[model samples]
Target: MSLQSSNDGPLDFVKYQNVVDGKLVASSNGETYHNINPSTLETNPEVPLSASDDVDKAVIAAQKAAESWAKVPWDERKKRLMDFADALEAHTEAFSQMLVKGNGRPPLHQKIIYDKLI
Candidate 1:
């Protein structure tokens, strides 16, 4: 039910949903697919199998947000981008472990890559 990474600690069970309109939502038909951990060959989470309807809804949401996003000031946009980068840097270890688990890569390899990037 959950993904466990030795380096990152335990991840609680979660149902991965499609992000539509900045909200987590299931597929229109409630279809799901297993997110299997490659190393352990275990299902950690279930992600939505989005259909055409879900794609349409997501496209609409993006179209609606595009105008406002484009109007944002350059400074504010840069700040937001920096903030996102900072957050990712802060969680590099956890993310590296996740990459290892999901892709069946050696933990050391992932850690090295994360170190180089972050």
Candidate 2:
């Protein structure tokens, strides 16, 4: 994220958020907790410390989305899922970095997942 911690100057973090109803959001209280990289022991990324309200919102959004998705044809859904996979494949490098930054995932772990995606 291009956000600065309260006491720190600037954070060199890749923005991460909770996506609800097609919108990105922070915790209900706007609170965040550090995600420390296991290898470096550095908190490069900070993530939302969601509340029960966030879970409720996400559940409601998922229900609404499921209702709409159920109406879509199976073939169209399949095509869209394939397209998503293709998009992920296209951004394997960047996505891998994000995974590593967001969680302390090893390169091999990412490689295995990418290989399965292929």
Local accuracy by lDDT, each model: 0.76, 0.75
Q: Find the 10 residues in a row with the least total lDDT in model 2.
A: 1-10
lDDT tens per residue, model 1, 32-64: 887678888876667789999999999999998
If scored against the real structure, what TM-score would every candidate get? 0.77, 0.79
Local accuracy of candidate 2 as per-residue lDDT tens digits, 1-118:
2122234533333666888888889989998887677776777667898999999999999999999999999999998788667755766776676667656779779767766866
Q: Can you list the residue pairs that collide in candidate 2?
A: 1-13, 1-14, 1-15
> What's the distance in Å from true for residue 109, model 2?
4.0
lDDT of 1: 0.76
Candidate 2 Cα misplacement greater than 4 A, ranges? 1-13, 102-105
What's the true lDDT of residue 46 in model 2? 77
